[model samples]
Target: DDSLRRFVTFEPRANVAMSVNLLVEPTRSDADAGFIVLQADRAHPMSGSNCICVVTALLESGRVPMSEPETVVRLDTPAGLIVARAACRNGQ
Candidate 1:
């Protein structure tokens, strides 16, 4: 989907929204998810908000398994690991 990358833009040099990451398959053994961060200028390791978006996308989109109460998502970023617990109700 690199071709679709053009649709997204980073501007004003904001710390939080200056970059974004795309989730991919894990490249390591200890990771449940893998991601690559793309900045306005260059690519980076990770972003906290981007990680949140990724985990949410995975669960909400049914890419990751879900449970009635909670579901744990262990992500592997280029920088390190991210563990997220998502609360679910009515498949949300």
Candidate 2:
């Protein structure tokens, strides 16, 4: 898994100590994307920040369709399924 470790490594010059590593699965009918979150070199049960980031990344990147007022994102995680509501404006 050296490749994966290298991929997730944050450049020390950037002042980042660690980075969240997400293994994203193909989009499913029920969920936009499924993923497992890895942090501190191990899998975590869940992370609020990680979930929020995932939702935002999906919508903003057009991985999931964005609605004007709101976007619903379904995330499949190791803990369980998470349904997140994202407030959107001007494609942001």
Candidate 3:
């Protein structure tokens, strides 16, 4: 699948620490994105901190736009859908 392909290409060999969040485009209508929480050996469902990380990444990387003071993003995970808000300033 695309998720495994992405993990193989982006993790393990890279310098990134293990158990990082890998965000993908959502396959469901209710979500704006899909995320796979990569660990040293396996992938897990969405976690609180990782969810925050994914949301932050979306806003910081401009994959999702940031609003004046806050940006809301919905993520689809193995567990379920997660909605999050991020603080923004000057598009950061």
Best by lDDT: 3
lDDT of 2 by residue, 1-92 (tens): 65554456535422245557374883556877887665445667678888898888888889889998988889878787789999999999
lDDT of 3 by residue, 1-92 (tens): 45663555464554345566777778899888899887655677868988888887888888887887988898999998888877788877
- Counted clashes in each candidate structure: 0, 0, 0
List residue ranges in candidate 2 displaced over 4 A: 1-17, 26-29
Candidate 2: residue 1 lDDT (0-100) = 62
- Note the Cα lDDT for every prediction shown: 0.75, 0.74, 0.77
Model 2, position 78, has a per-residue lDDT of: 73
Superposed on all Cα atoms, model 1 deviates from the true structure by an RMSD in Å of 4.4
Q: lDDT of candidate 2 vs native?
A: 0.74
TM-score of each: 0.72, 0.76, 0.75
Instruction: Note the residue pairs that clash in candidate 3.
Output: none
Candidate 3's TM-score = 0.75
